[model samples]
Target: MTDPLAGRVLRGDRRAVARAITRVENGDDSTDLLNGIGKSLGRAFILGLTGPPGTGKSTLVDRIIAQYRGRKMKVGVIAVDPTSPITGGALLGDRVRMAQHTLDSGVFIRSMASRGWSGGLSGAVSEAIQILDAAGMEVVMIETVGIGQSDIEIMKIAHAVMVVTMPGLGDDVQVSKAGLMEIGDIYAVNKSDLPGADAMVVNLLSMVRDMKGRSPPVLKVSALKGEGVDRLFDAVEAIRGRFLSPAGEEMRLRSVRGMIVELAKKKLLSEFEGRAFARSVEVARKVADHKMSYEEAAERLVDG
Candidate 1:
């Protein structure tokens, strides 16, 4: 709990912060570093942006970073990219697109390989977010890999989830689907300069009309042209303000609780995979031979 690296990270040293995140990504046991900064966590807001491929999510993130930095806020970005088969690393580093902020020092951007995580986010993203939060980043944004229906897992970790989409490419219908529509706190129709942008916005608005509680707002944004980005920033800030309010305390606490549960589950699953994998073949043979029931084999595995 008294790690020098953690102290440096807490002091907002960008290099130390980067090193901490790298340790997490490389699967090094970072329990001490995390504990060192545990008390300083939960102050930063976690914003998640997810959408299908070709939605220009990277460009939108670039614009959003400028919005936060203009207010003198320290911002952190985690861009989860697809895994590279050859190198087992992030295939498309989004840092390339946000090159303008390379020397800002106030902005820290990291690209992580999804590493075959099924949910479009890197497995180490939560740890990386905690590192950034401890580093005094007022806003930590997570841009997930291009996602589909099952990739809405970002909802569990993010304080606010923005689902970005564009006109054409059947995005209007895609957003209306069950999983995507339910997870979005806000929807941004990117590439509003395109032909079908207005209709896309209308379709989303109509879909969210009967969505029990606060309906997610649909915004028309052209990330490439900087159109409607200011308004988008205003909307994002509004959500941030709400999350920081007294009434939203339970929501924030719930997110923290969920994160803890997820971490515990991951730890248990890692152990189970390591132990149970070796017994799998034998267990399957016993079950196939009717020497042991499936339930019994499962119980045996768990007990071992």
Candidate 2:
């Protein structure tokens, strides 16, 4: 029998969307669910926002929503917030600034707990984006769980990524240290009302100039004050167009190839563990004891 939930999701039913996301958060990998949403994916433009904690990424997301809504397009948001270790859940305050649209039928919002990912986002976010795209959202925005330099996996999920920064953080030198400069397609220097804002902008521009290829634009926006948001939205639209063009197909293919490798690795690990968990643990202990190399141990597991 066809799953009614899948039908509801494709029709853009909010409750069904919420229910489906809940399954994803709980680590559901049911074949039926994936098959249901498979063909309908990749229609919406995905915008990913990532930066250090306390940079007000959520506020910027709200601003993006308003811009898309102004054009009468349906919008979907996935706010990935840190999960509470004690409760394994999140307060989900990411939507507080967006409370005004709680009743809007054109907007759909879902908050997912990062589930102990200090820098790694919950693996379920990509699936969530696919659901929203299949549901016909014109634009889907993913606000990452506040991340630092080591977490760059968000790039694989979004067609265009916005790295939001602000004044009074460390020097622009921190951008490369944080590994952000290489991944950002667009940059927003939020909290532009604060001191050092212009310096921040110029620093970002100088950094971009040093890069080899396409220099991404960095705009200043006071996300708190809703200043310069229009310029940011326009940049996103322009970048979105570029992502859909033939020139950008290589980038898209690269992203897909990476995702495929990740999935295959996960599948291999699962099968390896099912048959050889005890053996793998023994090899791990040997490696830790400096008696065996990890490369040899990996070969053992794969060859076994």
Best by TM-score: 1
TM, every model: 0.87, 0.83
lDDT of 1 by residue, 170-263 (tens): 8555565536777788899999988899988888888777678768889999988899999999999998998899977976997787567666
Q: How far in Å is the alpha carbon of 265 misplaced in model 2?
A: 3.9
> 11, model 1: CA deviation in Å?
1.1
What is the alpha-carbon lDDT of model 1 when measured against the actual structure? Answer: 0.78
Displacement of the residue 179 alpha carbon in candidate 2, Å: 0.9
Worst 10 residues of 2 by lDDT: 83-92
Cα-based lDDT for every prediction:
0.78, 0.73
In the order shown, what is each candidate's alpha-carbon RMSD? 3.7, 4.1
